[model samples]
Target: MGRSIYCVVTAAGSGTRLGHNEPKALVNLAGKPILHHALCGLEPLGDLAGVAITAPANYLETFTQIAREAALSYPWTVLPGGSSRQKSVYEGLKGLLSFEPGNGQLPANDPTAIVLIHDAARALTPIAQFERVCQAVESGCPAVVPATELIDTVREVKGDTFTRQGLKITPAGSTPDRSRLRCVQTPQGFAGDIIFAAHDRAREESICEGEAVDDAVLVATLGHEQYFVPGSMRALKITYPLDLKLATWLAENPDRD
Candidate 1:
C-alpha cells in the first residue's frame, strides 16, 4: 500500500506587511485568493490522505470556505491557528492526529506517514517542487526541504558601531561562505512521527519563539539529519506589495518557469 500523506498548511500570518485588511492567506493573487492557489498546488499529489489548515482564529470559516472552493478530492480540516508560527504548526499536527481515516476507525500513529508542512504565502509554488520534496522524503530522508542557492553575498553583523567620521555603522562580524549557503522554502516533507515528536518536544521544553526557526530546525534538535531538493523561483513568497506584483506576472506567464 502507498504511504498516507497529510498536509498541514500554515496561514496564520496577519499580512500587515502586505497592507491587506485580511489575513495573508486571504489576500488575492491573480483571480484567486492566495490560499486557493496554495491548495491547488497540491492537486497533482495522487496519494494525499488529507490536509489540515491552520487559519486566523477569526477567519477559520473564511479559510474553510476557501478550501472547499478549491474542491480538492481529499479530506480537509480547518482549525484555529496559534499565536506564533511554531505553535500554529503544532496545533495543525494535533488536528491531523485526530483525523478519522474513513473506515469508522481512528487514524493510526503511522510513523511512516508522510506529512507536508506548507505556507500559504508561497501561493505560486509549483507542483514539481511538491513532487521533488516528497520523493526525497520517500527515499529514506527523515526530513526534506526545498531550497534555492543564494546569489548574493552574505555578511554577519556584529552590532551598531561608528566609523572614523562618527557615522553610525554596523560592521561585518564575518563573511559566510556564500557557496555553502542556501535559502530554504516550504512544503517541507517529513515522516509523520518525526515531525510530531519534534513538535511535542518543543512544547515540553518550552522552546523560545526565536529558537524554533522551522520544522527542520525542530527536527534537527532531535539529531535527525535533513536533506534538500532543488527549489524554484516560482515558489517566491508573497510578502510585500512588490512581491505580489511579481507573483501576478509569474502567474500570467506560467510557461516561463
Candidate 2:
C-alpha cells in the first residue's frame, strides 16, 4: 500500500519585514491572498491524508475563510499559531495528530506516514517540487528539502562598519566555496513519526522558539541527514517589497515556465 501524506502550511508570520500591516500570508500575490496561492499548489496532491494551517491567533477566522473558499477535498483545519516560526510549525504538527486516516484513525506510531511542512510566504512554489519531495520520502528518505544552487558569490563577514542610515556594513572575512552552498526552500518532507519525535525532543531540550530556522534543522539536531531535491526559482520566498513585486510578476506570468 502507498504511504499516507499530510501537509502543514505555516502562515502565522507577521509581515514586518515585508512592511505590511497584515500577516505575510494574507498579502495578495495576484488577485488572491498569498495563502491562496500556497494552497493552490497543494491542490494537485489528490491523495493527501489531510492538511493543517497555522495562522495568527487573531486571523484564524480570516485564514479559515480563505481555506474554505479554496474548496479542497481533503480534511483541513486552521489552528492558532505560536509566537515564533518554530513554535508555529510545532503547533501545526500538534494539530495534525487529530487527522483521521483512511484506515480509520492515525496510529500512535505510523512509520509509513509522511508530512510536508511548507511556508505560506513562498506563494509561487511549483507543484512539481511538492511531488519531488513526496517521492523522496516514499523512496525511504526520512527527511527531504528542496534547494536551489547559489548563483552569487557568498562571503562570511567579520568587522562591522556603520552607515549614515544606521545599517551596519560588515567586511568579508572569508568566501566559502559556492559549489558547496545551496539556498534551501520549503515544503520540506519527513516521516511523520520522526518529525513528531524531533519536535517533542526540541521541547524537552527547551529549544528557543525561533532558534531553528526550519524543521529540517531541528531534525538535523536529532542527527538525521536531509536529502535535497531541485527547487524552482519561482518558489522564491517573498520577504521584502521587491520580492513581492517579483512574486506578483510570476503570478501574472504563469506560462513563463
Candidate 3:
C-alpha cells in the first residue's frame, strides 16, 4: 500500500458571484451540493485516511448534514472555518490531525503521511487526479500541485493605481512567454509534517496581507521545492455565474475533455 492520505477541504467561501444566499459550498451542483461533489471526487483515493471540512461558522450543522448525506466510507468532520482560506485550511489541518481513531485516541502524527488540500469550489475535479497527486507525494515529492499551461496570450500591467473614475489604471507593460507560465489547481498534496510545519510557520510569521497566499506559496517560502502534475480542465474553479453555467454543462457531460 502507499502512504495514507488526509484531506483538508476549504469550503467557507461566500459565493457572492454565484449570487446565492448560501455559501459557495452549499450551492447546488448536479443533484447534490458543491461540497458533496468535491468529497465524491476524493472517493477514488484508496488510502484516504481521513477528511476535515471547514465551512462558514453559521453553517456548520448544514455542512455536517451534507457530508453525512454523502455517505463517505472514511472518517470525516465538519467544523467552523476562519475568515480566510489560508486560516480555514490551517484550522482544517488541526481538526484532521486531532481525529480520534477506533481506539478513541488521536493517531500518532506521521511525518510521512500525505495530506491533500482542496477547494470545494473545484467540485468538478476528476477522481483520478486525487490519486495522481497522492501517488506523486508518496513517490517522494515533498510538495505537489496539479497545474496546466496557460494557452492564451499573457500581458503584464504596470503603474497600479485607482483612476479618477474608480477604475484601476493598469497600463499594458510587456507580454511574458505563455509557455513558462501555468495556472495552478488543487488538491495540492504534501508530506504531512512538512505542510503542517509550513502552515505553523506562516501563522507565526503573519506573512502577507490577510494571509492570501496558498499552501504551495507557503511551502515555497519555506524553501521547499514543489513539483507539478498534469491538471485537468475539468478541475475548473466555479467563481462567477458564467463559470457555474459552464460547470453545469460539464457536469452533464463528464466524458468531455
TM-score of each: 0.93, 0.94, 0.92
Candidate 2's TM-score: 0.94
Model 2: per-residue Cα lDDT over 168-208, one tens digit each: 77665889999999999999999888898888899889765
Per-residue error for 75 in candidate 3, Å, reads 0.6
Misplaced by over 4 Å in model 1 are 102-109, 161-167, 209-211
Q: Across residues 1-70, which tens digit of lDDT does each residue of candidate 3 receive?
A: 3566789999999988899978999888877889999988788677667899999999999999998888
Best by TM-score: 2
The list of candidate 2 runs beyond 4 A from truth reads: 103-109, 161-171, 208-210
Candidate 3 off by > 4 Å? 101-109, 161-169
Consecutive 10-residue window with the lowest summed lDDT within model 2: 100-109
CA RMSD (A), model 2: 2.0
lDDT of each: 0.86, 0.87, 0.85
Candidate that scores best on lDDT = 2
